[model samples]
Target: MDDSIKPNEDIGACIPRLRRYARALLGVRGEADDLVQDTLERAWRKLHLWRRDTELRPWLFSIMHNIFIDQRRRAPEETVSLDEHALEFPVAPAQERMMEMVDLESALRMLPAEQREVILLVGLEQLAYKDVAVALGIPVGTVMSRLSRGRERLRELMEGRQRVVALKVVK
Candidate 1:
């Protein structure tokens, strides 16, 4: 097998996992797909920075995580009115959600982005804690704490326990 082909194959195999994570994290098909495209482009351009000794999957995810963080920090770019360009927008999926999954998705949406990333990485991707740390560029302890907090919050949301905050009154 040619060495070039092997590397391409490896990267190709990871696309599905990246798409799944992106979709879960972003909750929109178009945005998720765009993120995946950006990730692959970045990975290909920075392939030299990747160490041969380390696993490629985690490194690819790290690149993706960094890109996502950078995008979050920047102000939104020029907006296109979807209503005016309905032909440009893709049709939404026709699948109907079960009640439980809808609730779960809504609950996931409510989570802080940090907690949501950690939970989806660990729970949905089934990545090891160490790999998650590497992917997110955080320590293992941080990943564990985020995952723990996220899971607890998810359970609370699923159980319909709304968190109440007591507002201070100054008059």
Candidate 2:
């Protein structure tokens, strides 16, 4: 067995999870793919910096997180302009499941980026609290707080109670 190739194999094993996180973060297929490609490129270039004793998955996630933050900083005003026609496609046969997914996606999009990232890392990606904190470079307390808020907001959004403004009595 070539010891030199072991790290590469380990990194390869993480690509699917990386892609999933990228897709969830970016919410667009092409953009997610681009982010993953950039992440891989960056990781390959910095492979020497990675310590053998450290876990690879969280390190890869941290790289992806930094890249994502950098990209967002570079284009703070960038928005995806979707075509209305593109969204008029037919629904899937499992309409209830599809609707639930749509609702979840909508709620996710509604979350603040920090909260969204924490929630996705903890909830969707199943990352541990400490790993999430390392990936985001935040304290564990902050992760807990953000995850709590994110879950609450998601629940509110899913339940159609996102609006918090109180109604005034009419004369």
Return the top candidate by TM-score.
2
| Candidate 1 residue runs with Cα over 4 Å from true position | 1-5, 76-97, 161-171
Tens digits of per-residue lDDT for model 2 on 64-127? 9999999989999757547312333358789788777777876787888889899999988999
Q: Which stretches of candidate 2 lie over 4 Å from their true place?
A: 1-5, 83-93, 161-171
lDDT of 1 at 126: 88
C-alpha positional error of residue 80 in candidate 1 after TM-score superposition, expressed in Å: 15
lDDT for model 1, please: 0.81
Worst 10 residues of 1 by lDDT: 162-171
lDDT of each: 0.81, 0.83
Local error of candidate 2 at residue 151 (angstroms): 0.7
- What is the lDDT for 86 in model 2? 37
